[model samples]
Target: MKIQEIREIIKLIDQSTLTEFSYESEGTKIKLKKYESSSIFTNGQQLDSSSVVEQPKVAEVKAALAPVVQQQKEVVTETVEVAEESKLHKIKSPMVGTFYQSSSPSEAAYVQVGSKVTGESIVCIVEAMKLFNEIEAEIDGEIVEILVKDGQLVEYGQPLFLVREN
Candidate 1:
C-alpha cells in the first residue's frame, strides 16, 4: 500500500472514536492503536485534553533506568563508580510499528550516530497501520546511537536512539 493511502486511513481513524484499527493486503499487515492516558493537572489547573504535552526526555529515560541502576548497584556494591554518567537521552517510539530509517528504501538513513539533531529534527519513520509517522528527536542532542535497525519492529516506548544532550 502507498504511504499516501495509509496517511488517509490514519486521518480517518484519528477523526473517529475507534481505539484500534488494522488492515491487511497482499501479505502486508498493518496495525494502529490509540494510547489513552489519564489527564494530568498542575497547580490544580486542568490541562486541555487536546493539548500536546512534551514530556521531559531525561525524566522518562531516568525512570526507565531505575531497575537497571538497582541491579548494577547490587552487583558492584562499594566498588560502584559514582562518576557522572553521560547526559544522553533516548528518542522512543510513540507507537508499536515497523521502523524505517529513512523515507524510502533507496534513501539514506535519516539520523545516524554522531548526527546532531534538534527537537524538530526527523530521526526516523514509524509506520503504524500503514501510516508513516515521522519520529522526531524531540530533544536537542547529538545522536550517539541508533538502537533500532532499518525496518525493525519497535514497541511503543522502546528506545530508538541514544542522543547525548547538547
Candidate 2:
C-alpha cells in the first residue's frame, strides 16, 4: 500500500530464487519481478531500469504485464494446443513395486472398464515390499481403460487407470 510495504515485498522476493512476486489489497496491487539480462537483451546489451521509477506507473505496468505474461505461459501448456498424447490424465503410482487389482488373488478387481470412481474409491494396491498399500482415486471420473493388469510391476507415478471426467 505504501513505499515501505513495496520495499519490504521487494526485499522478500530478492531473498529467494523467485523471478516474480505479487500482492493485492483494497484495489491496490504490487509486484516484484527479476528480469534476467539474457532474456530481455536488445542486440548484445541488457536493459536495466534500476533508477528510481514512480510507484503508480510501476504498479500499473506490473499489473498489466502480469496477466499478459501469464497468458503467454498458459498458451504453451494449454491442453487444446497440446498433442493428444499429452492430454491423457496420467493416474500415477504413489509408491513403487507390484500393482494388484484386488485385495487378494481370487477376489474381484477393485475397478474395471467403465467403473465410476469418486475421490475416495480405492482404485488399486501397490505392494512395496511386503505391505500392500491401497491406492485411492483423487478425482471423480469414469474409468476409460486399465493401463496395467493385476500382479504387474509398476513404477511410482505410472498411470493405472484412464478416468474420463463424468
Candidate 3:
C-alpha cells in the first residue's frame, strides 16, 4: 500500500474509537491498535498515545510497512563494519519515554561516541510522566554510536546506544 493511503487510514483510525485495525495486501500487512491505558501499538511496538488527534509517527508507519527480515539484511549490508557491529552490545531503553543525553539542557552529555563506560555509569536519561530516569550502560565498554537523538521518544527495549566491550 502507498504511504498516502496509510496516512489516510491512520487519520481515520485516530478520529474514530476503533481499538484495533489490520490490513494485508500482497505481502504487505499493517496493524494498528490502541490500548485502554492510552498507548498505541503498531505491529506489536508501542507508540505514545497521549493525544487522540496526534497521528502515528512517520517512522513507525514505515516500519510497519517494511518487511522485517529485508530491513535487517539491508541494515547489515549497508554498514562496512558489519563484523565489528555484530559484536557490539546494545544499550536499550528500559521504558517508553523521551531520551535525553544530558541531565539538563546546559549540561554536557553523559556519554558520547568513544566514551568509556562501566556497568554502573549513567549513560543517559529517560523522562516519562515528569519523572527523570537515569539509564546505566550495564556493561564495561566504549560507546560506538548513539542511536537516538536527544528529546526523541524511545520505546521500551529500543536500542539507545551501541557499545564495544573492552
Candidate 4:
C-alpha cells in the first residue's frame, strides 16, 4: 500500500479505538497497534498467500478475550440481580444453551415474574442442540425475578428465576 493510504489507515485506527489492525497483500504485510503511536511493520518479505484470503474478524476474537483476562484476576461481573431470603428457591438451568421464555415467536411466555407456579409448572425452556428442554419449577412459588433474558446463552447451573414459595 502507498504512504497516503497507510496514513489514512493509521488515522482511522487512531480515531477509532481499535486496539490492533493488520493488512497484507502482494507479498507485503503490515501490522498496526493503537496502544501507542509506534506500529510494528514487517515488509518486503512475502506472506503466505493463505494468510491474505482468510482474514479473521478481530473484533469477535477480542470480544471473547475479555473474559479470560477477567478470569485471571477473579470473576468480575456487574450484578444485574439480587436474592431474597424466604421460603423459596431459585430455578436454575440444568445445561448450557440459549434460554427462551416462549416456545415460539408468537407464543405467550410460559411464566413471568410475579406469576404463580406449581412444582410441575413449565417455567422456561433451555434450547440445547436444537432441542428445547422444558424446565419445570421444582418448588411451588410466586416468581420474584427472572434472571436470564430471552434468547440469551445460559450456562449450566445458572440462575434462571427466583421464586418465593406460597
Task: Give the least accurate 10-residue stretch of model 2, judged by summed lDDT.
Answer: 49-58
Best prediction by lDDT: 3
lDDT of 3 by residue, 13-72 (tens): 665566687876446788999556667677898877664465556465456546644655
Q: Which candidate is the best by TM-score?
A: 3
Candidate 3 global TM-score: 0.53
What is the C-alpha lDDT profile of model 4 across 1-166, one tens digit per residue? 4576567566555545467877654455769885533333348655553333243354644453444445433522322122134335979899999999999979999998799999999998999999989999989889988988999999999989989988
Give candidate 1 regions above 4 Å deviation. Answer: 1-86
TM-score of each: 0.50, 0.48, 0.53, 0.49
Give the Å error, residue 51, model 2: 80
Candidate structures ordered by TM-score, highest first: 3, 1, 4, 2
Candidate 3 pairs with clashing backbones = none
Clashing pairs in 2: 93-157
Which residue pairs come into collision in candidate 1? none
* CA-RMSD of model 1: 26.1
Q: lDDT per prediction?
A: 0.76, 0.73, 0.84, 0.74
Measured by TM-score, how close is model 2 to the native structure? 0.48
